[model samples]
Target chain A: MEKIKSIIEVKNLNKSFGSNHVLRDFSMEVVPGESLVILGKSGSGKSVLIKCIINLIVPDSGEIYVLGQNIRELDQDQMDKLRAEVGFLFQSNALYDSMTVRQNLEFPLRRHWTKEMRDLNAQSAVKEALEDVGLGHTIDMMPAELSGGMRKRIALARTLILKPKVILYDEPTTGLDPITAREISELMLQVQEKYKASSIIISHDMNCIRMTSDRVIMLIDGRNYISDTYENLQNVPDPKVREFFD
Target chain B: MIHLIKIDSEFLREVGEIARFTGRFFSEVIKPKQEWEEFINQCFWIGFKTLTLVGITAFIMGLVMTIQSRPTLLEFGAVSMLPAMVSVSLVREIAPVITALICAGKIGSGIGAELGSMRVTEQIDAMEVSGTNPFKYLVVSRVLASTLMVPLLSSLAIAISLYGGYLGVNIRGNVSWHLYWLQSFGALGYGDFIPSLIKTFFFGFAIGIVGCYKGYNSKKGTEGVGRSATSAVIVASLVVFIIDLIAVQVTDLLGLT
Candidate 1:
């Protein structure tokens, strides 16, 4: 096997809400260009782990290094700059409801790209991104106007527009029907192939996990219980791991 | 009395939270030094869109004040004083206070609901994780708009109110429109106008900050959104009255009264 670089790494990540202790000594890593899914039952602190990776919900006592810089050492400006290279796709699709698809895609460019760069490249960048999701024609439509599947696709497109090296998907397939879920799962694969961006998907959707994840980490009891390929983990005899499979 | 003297933890917690939130607002507000388009958009939504409701309420307030004061004035042979009295009260205290209260009900709740929805939907989180400053884009613009717009809206309401008072004066007597406008202006002085106008900026700040705080710190779920909206209006309206009380005392101290 060829050597793979760990693009993202977490060590002893401890986050607690009061005495609830959501993420305790949790640790994981994502290698470059691989799709890693953190599988947990709802409220198993999967979201917290991802949010901590992005420095959204700060972990109580642990370290996270994204790309190269330690997230805690980086100031707000640096964190924001780092965020541009790490795309977060919310489960709600969090598409700015007031904005159209084009405006939504253009939003990040306005913030990250200088005026001259945006003036020169924003139009084509937005169109190319939309086309990547097969929704180039829906650019002018409001987020409210799009169906759930389309909104999800557009959100992925918006995430891709930044050409992020790390894509974080929080339950990307939670609310979709079976068919839409499969489509989104397929889209995730296509995104991984096309952009070659590493991703950490926080979900329990078996189909999505099967289709997109190169590796799976089961977040159990605020800790990384098991880390393995899907085929290997499914065949394990441990009840905790097998519970998810059954 | 002993219980009242002892500070409640919840109240102290809220005060601390609000102070910290206020500090963050001022801190973020200075720079990267831009958000003009969002600011103008907020002003329209928070200021222009609120005109109709405020206008109607102000007009009716002036009309009622005049009508209510007439019979009492007649008893004292001061019927001619109706326009002056109505205009004075409307501009000095009633107009700003009433308009602010109405705005607290409308703008405060609207901000609470919208931001609450955004917070719950993770739109605010999306903005943050996407490397956008939600505070500058959302909080500061809305706060600045309210601080700037409430006074203008209050002044407009007062003018409409004075006209309503004129109609009220005409209902029972024969006060001409020109004479009514003259008396309306005649009754107001620097003492009456400046304090009322000044206090409204405080009122606007109170409303905007309270609404944003409630919404921004809202708990998870749809129920939390409802609580945020309700708590925003309640807190904003309560602060308006408190601000009015303090303003009155300060004006008295300054001999503006």
Candidate 2:
């Protein structure tokens, strides 16, 4: 048995929107190269937790450490720099509608890579990322022209172009058909293995969670209610844990 | 009374937010990370693409003002006063404000809807998460474009309007193009040109600022996009009038009017 390094640690996070308390004393840790799924129904604060980890939404009270630096202590510049290492796939795909797929893929490189570097390697990087998602030919098409499955793949390709150490997927399979969902699930597995990337997937899709997540955390009532392997968690007789399996 | 208070509070909150948003724009715009490419593209869109609309509106306005004012001046046997009256009114007030109003409808709504759709669709978020400055790329470019274009548009508008008044003068009367030009130019003073031009920059700023704020702070889902676009035009239109009033007052105090 080998020891695994902790890539992300979230402890005692509390968030509220006026009267609506979203996350309460929620805590979790994600080890390096692991797939951890946060499963919650609508409005259960699963998305909020992922946002907090990425420094998008600040929690009312919490300690979040990413790659050993306390997120709260990082300045805006530091947070922005850290963002390049942590890829986030928004549920809506968020492909730049005004830009073509190649341009969208080039966006991060333009920001993070120097002009010379981008000029020299951007084309190759875009091609490789597109190839990773199996959509190499759709590079020049607009986001509007792409099918949902294709758009999602483009977004994944965009995220992968940066070769982010940790990928945060927010409802990656939410709006897809069952077949598409299964394909996306398989892609997530492939991404994990290929990139050797630690990932925090925020999802409610049973098939997605079952296939992609190595460990699942049930988020209910604004808390991390249960955390275990998929098969082991199914055996738990507790009603709260059983609710997910049943 | 309670409703009134609520409205007042909401207004104050929005004002505060706009101020903060403006501050953020300034900070990002000055930083080494600049979006000159996007800014130039926006300048072309906001300035060049808007030329036809502004020209048509300005032409109609100059002609209509000449026609409408002719009756009153004619009663006093002051038919020759037509060009001077229309010219002064158009250059000093009408052209700038009318063009601004048109921009409030056209540019303001366009920017609002574009950014609103981006916000709702999470393109803005994607930019941020990818470590790109959305404000710098989106807001600074558009605002700078509007601020620069308004004055140029107003100047173009004034020229076209004078031409329009010239055509109106010839419709029922014989005034040479030379005399019409002399009268129109003679009527415009340093006072009229400077004050009117300055105020338009503010109008441009107002339109750009209000539109961006509405769209950037839009709520979630499809309906939020509509709300963002509508509120952008409404608030921008209102702010144009308010800015015009303030500009007039300031010029009056300085004896520029």
Candidate 3:
């Protein structure tokens, strides 16, 4: 296997809420154009880790280098610029309930471009994003009208609209049916291949771990146990690793 | 004693929450993107939807005030003072306060419930994770809508109230419609109109910010959404009266009357 350039590097990341230590000196890295899956139980700082990398929540003491830039140290405007290059899919698809699917896709695009700059040209981009996610026919439907799987697909369309360099998935398959989950995992691969972007997925689903990851990182008790290939992870003899799979 | 202490602590916590929520309004107001579309939507919801209710109430209010005051004026042989008194009371004190109270019941609860459900269902978290600024989109837009729209609604309500007052005068006797308006405006100077109008903006701001705050910070489930909606309406109503009282005292101290 060829080693690619590191697009993200984290060192000594620490975060806490009041007395609960969420992420304690956590650290890891993702190579450019590689797919990495983070495996952890709920409340183990998986979501916080993703948020900190994007500077949504500032870490207490740490360094997060995304695309070779220290994301933690950047100012708000600078951070916003950096954030535009990264896409995030939330556990619960956060489509605006009040808006139609088309409006949801257009929201991020219109926000990124001013009204005068956003004309007929951007409309095609929104349509293309909708088509990419297999949601072209559901453009006028509200999120409440869609099933869970369909909503997730629309959210993916919105995320891809920005053409992000890195895609972060937070529990992408948590509540989906097995078939839907499989399709989502497959779509993740498709997105990776199409965009040629680095991808990070946080999940407890072993099926998702096995299917979507090129490298697996186990997070147990606020620490990284191992970062290796899926086959290597399954063959390991660590009690914690065994327990996770069991 | 312990129970009393617990109650006090709970009250303080609620008060602190409301104050913190209101404080955030100032902070978010200075931020960018304005969320103009969302603001217009909120105006449509808060001002346009509630217009009929506010109008009816104001109209009845004017009718009742005029009718009640006419008899009292007649008893004192000062029947001409009816228009002046009703207009002064409505424009200066009654209209803004009543309109705000009604809005606190309607718009405040709506905002609180909407945002609270959104919070509980993880919609807000989704916005943040998606690299969208929820504060700018949700808080600023709603606040701007309330601040701008409430005044317009209040003006419409006052106008309706005056029409109702005209009807009240015509019921028992004849008063020229033109003279009735003249007398109404005769009593209202810029002193009454400007201060009263100025304070409605704050009233609107308070209602909007408090509703958004309560809903935005709602707890993890369905019950929390209800609590947020209830608290928002209660706190917003209290804020309206508090602002009205302060406005009255300040205006009196300034000798504007």
Total clashes in model 3, counting residue pairs 3 or more apart in sequence or in different chains: 0
Highest DockQ model number: 2
Q: For model 3, how does the per-residue alpha-carbon lDDT over B143-228 read when each residue is reduced to its tens digit?
A: 88988878888888889998898898888768899999999999889999888889999999989988898899899699999999
Give a tens-digit lDDT track for model 3, residues A1-246.
544367888898898899988887888999889899999888999988997887767889989998878986677667767777888888877778888988888777655676766685577878888888787889899998999999999988888988999998989999999999999888888889998989889999998889989999888888887889989888899888888877
Worst 10 residues of 3 chain B by lDDT: B124-133
Candidate ranking under DockQ, highest first, comes to: 2, 1, 3
Cα lDDT tens digits, model 2, A1-246, are: 445368899999999999999999999999998899998789999988998998878899989999777999998789888898999999999999989999999999877899999999999999999999999999899999999999999999999999999999999999999999999999989989999999999998889999998899999999999899988898999988787778
Please give the lDDT score at residue A210 for candidate 2.
92
- What is the alpha-carbon lDDT of model 1 when measured against the actual structure? 0.91
Q: Sort all candidates by TM-score, best to worst.
A: 2, 1, 3
Candidate 3: TM-score? Answer: 0.91
Residue B241 CA error for candidate 1 (Å)? 0.3
Clash pairs, model 3 backbone = none
What is the CA-based DockQ of model 3? 0.41
Candidate 2, residues B13-84, lDDT tens digits: the string is: 989999999898888778896788998999999999999999999999888888888888999999998999
> On a 0 to 1 TM-score scale, where does candidate 1 land against the true structure?
0.96
True-structure RMSD, every candidate: 2.3, 1.9, 2.9
Candidate 1 Cα deviation (angstroms), residue A121: 2.1
**True C-alpha contacts between chains kept, each model in order:** 0.73, 0.76, 0.38
In model 1, what lDDT does residue B10 have? 70
Candidate 2: CAPRI quality band: medium
